[model samples]
Target: MLKRLLCLILLCAALPAAAWDNRGHRLTGELAHDRLQASDPAAVQAIVAIMARHPDKARFDRNLAGLTGEARTRRLFGLMARWPDDVRDTPADRPDWHYALKIVHGWTALDWYTAGKAEAQWAANLATARNAAAPPAQRAVALCWLLHIGGDMHQPLHRGHRLDGSWLKSDRAGTIAWVRRGPGLPPMELHQLWDKVFDPTGVDGGDENGDVTRLHAAFAPRAAAMVPDGGFVQWRDESEILARDSAYTGPALRATKAPAEAPPMTAAYMTMLRTIAERRVIAAGVRMGAALQGLR
Candidate 1:
């Protein structure tokens, strides 16, 4: 039964979705690593030791085995932060782990909540993770979820798809809104653009083992100050509303239910989108950094 369940989840992985590209996840992990370490050094050490058993052990070592002193520690913590996404491709991974059901607005719980939701799992996993007596492997898995899914929940789209009686389906959290990069530039999915674009317009940080320089938390000062003292539900509450935000709004966006035309993504709109995307990335980092209280 467990193997069958894992197979089902693996099929769901065919759908495309990424809350924050590697860089964004890395940034969030770094901030959270620092936040937890500064106040609870031992907690950070304990988590990292377990993560050393991450299913992808060889990759973890080859990529994160450089630097010295605090630099090495931060980088490992940052990489472990992204470990969950890697799990998405593994058989035992949770296909729905990257997102939660919309928990805001009128959707208060009555007893119908699914344990599979990222909101539920991250919080529950925190408790599992804090229990050092649990199997080391179980604790390691929980740590990855707390880091990766915790960050993903902060991404507004991942809060949940919005479908009012219409077919827009919240444009699949902006994925259906095909955006033209410039007047004649190659177009891409609006959601993907948000995932890929950078602050100040064109800061290109290669996503690789050596990409830590640009992924540093110091690069985003405003985000560092925006960390909130909250948990999974609060993070979802904050991000779920952004579906209606201007970045995801437009005539083309509204018609995405069935057959629809691509949106005319304007330069001004692109600039505004960049701004909102940057802030969201920063906020994810800040909140994810401070979100480790229970697990720590």
Candidate 2:
């Protein structure tokens, strides 16, 4: 009886720490790497140089967080889906639930809400580049960052409200709760499943033994195939199609159904989350390219 009780306690303790690790930051790095690989060699070099100069991983993550559109949604969905059951139940109010779903999920909603602002920003950038006769390289870099960040902002999890332990709060924000073992699952669980639908290998990174360049190079063809010679508008259209067909459709359908029990956050879910993070990174790359093209 003591052994069983100890095991239970151990499992319970392990839950929160596991939850803290599931965020878009991990995936964004891989996505950025993938985008650079798919890009023109010169562009890739330029981005790398810029990244090296910046040195602030948090800034990079924050920049990625600002992205919008389907790319953001898809990535967030991936992260949420793979979030550990224990972490998913962790509330935003709890400091230990550091990666609690609040900021990430809230950012997702905010992405939708502020999409127009993003569009306007793109337009303004384009105008500035055109009128000021900015160098193509400068214009391109700006455009790339814009697209990347916009996609980040669009992720639903990023837009989630921080539930400060308010009982009346409609949105759970960053709160941990018990996974009810029953036929009807909670909204949090539903949200989690939707986040993990993408394949992790598709995005890139995660393997210490893996060659990022090779991995990114391998996926370049698919990302490039999605791009037309003309540029960003085509990329935007492709992203929209992905959003409508893949990101929104799968989750919307699954969310309608109830789970028998709150699913445990498993390795499989982590894998799935990793995959979505990679894709979001890829989507940001594509969007960045598109934003630049619009400037031209």
Candidate maximizing TM-score: 1
lDDT of 1 by residue, 1-296 (tens): 43234323323333334677777777777777777676577777777778766666777788666677777777776776677776565786776767754422222231123223676778778787788788887887777777788777767667644333342123445566565555554556666666666432322344454454664634556654564666666667676666546544553354332223444566777677667666766676666666565453
lDDT of each: 0.61, 0.35
TM-score of 2: 0.36
Residue 132 shift from truth in candidate 1, angstroms: 1.1
RMSD of 1: 6.4
lDDT of 2 by residue, 1-296 (tens): 43233223322232212211223322433443344444544454443443333323343344348656534433332232222221234441222222212222212332222112334444554454344365554544343334333443334332232211221231332123222212343334423333332323322226421343354455445555555243434334444443334333322222322344334444544454446545544554454444333222
Assess candidate 2 and give its lDDT: 0.35
Q: Please list the residue runs of candidate 2 whose C-alpha ends up more than 4 Å from where it truly belongs after superposition.
A: 1-117, 120-147, 153-218, 229-284, 293-296
